[model samples]
Target: MCARIASPCVGLCSTTLGDSVCRGCQRTDDEISEWMALPAEQRDSRMVELDGLRERVAGRFLRIDDEARLEAQLKRHRIRFRPEQPPLSRAVELLRVGRDRIRDLQCYGLVPLEGAVGLTAAELHERLSARLLEEASRRRRALQACTDSHC
Candidate 1:
């Protein structure tokens, strides 16, 4: 039987902080509240959107030669992924594979940040996730400030 899809919550819920989007999962407050009520197909669609957002936010740090190599690595590691997933999404998965398996990210075409070589996979994931949240929070604060000033 196919495994059930899982919610994207990373256990760092920050919607209570007034973020329109959850800094953890990157889901909008509406999306998070309605997730359980949504049908499977709708949930899948929302997951796709979330993946795209993640890809866009983290794209700058990923460097891929092509999708084929990425796909092959993901397959070799038995990681579930869409066939036509974005490069950054695939890269993020590679990062999630943990440090030992992905010791040499350059082999997968991911550009390592200076001094990042010493960090473990989980550490890198946390760092990237934090950066994504920080960026989203910055944008949200800017929008709120603009709205407040205009009103």
Candidate 2:
């Protein structure tokens, strides 16, 4: 049997932002309120969706071959990070630093993808930042629309 899925609350609730969605956990206010009462199958499906969002929004930027390489890169760049943190959070910190310091990401095993190819480190960082922001904005809008329609 599969283990019971628990709430995705990261303790950084942002429901007060008036977006209906929690910026930290990505769950809408309604979902958050009803999480405990949700059926296992429904909860599992939501977890899958949240996981996909987490990966697309944050983990996609991490192109390292392994976690050790990522850790080394963080150390080499003097970027303070917690190994215990989620990969998404770590990737956010790693990508927030100046591109000059992390220009040669390949040296740290971060191979650029087709879209990132030929782009400078700064350009890649900007692209990733924009994508993250866009995703958040899209989610907020979606949640708002759902709320307006009472869905």
Candidate 3:
């Protein structure tokens, strides 16, 4: 069955048939009847039109690719105010946003970096986390030594 032309299924609702198109607002008996006769290109073109109609009736349909592309552009365009911040602070910021972005990239079918080629996002996160921990330990040790010397 075809989904409603006016509304896209957001993985919600149950149909009488496992795959029958929704019989609500947009798709009529005639549209469903002609669907099988349409050519592949025509069907694809129709699908795009149907998507817009669906969005009007339903909410926005956010494809992962759409979000990923937007996010990638945004990340590229972002201007960091404090470029001189210490590595720890930068690492913290990266951990907060970079981790989510990396996950989004992978979800959007972006090819992750090869091990020998370059650092993957996951690899970069691990390295940053380890480096931050090591730096913190060193700072603690230096502080302890300074306190002992003063005492």
The clash numbers for all candidates, in the given order, read: 0, 0, 3
What TM-score do all the candidates reach, one by one? Answer: 0.61, 0.56, 0.32
lDDT of candidates 1 onward, in order: 0.70, 0.67, 0.39
TM-score of 3: 0.32
Task: List model 2 lDDT by residue over 1-151, tens digit each.
Answer: 9665576675657787675666656677878889988998898788667656655765555555566777777788776554445444555556656475666766665666667777777777677766755676687688788889999
What is the per-residue lDDT of model 3 for residues 88-143, given as tens digits with 9 covering 90 to 100?
A: 23223333345545544334323323331255556554554444334434444665
Per residue, candidate 1 scores C-alpha lDDT tens digits across 120-147 of: 6667777777777776666557767888
Report the error of model 3 at residue 20, Å.
60
Q: How does candidate 1 score on lDDT? A: 0.70
TM-score, predicted candidate 1 vs. hidden true structure: 0.61
Pairs with steric clashes in candidate 1: none
Q: Which candidate model has the greater lDDT, 1 or 2?
A: 1
Superposition error at 141 for model 2 (Å): 0.5
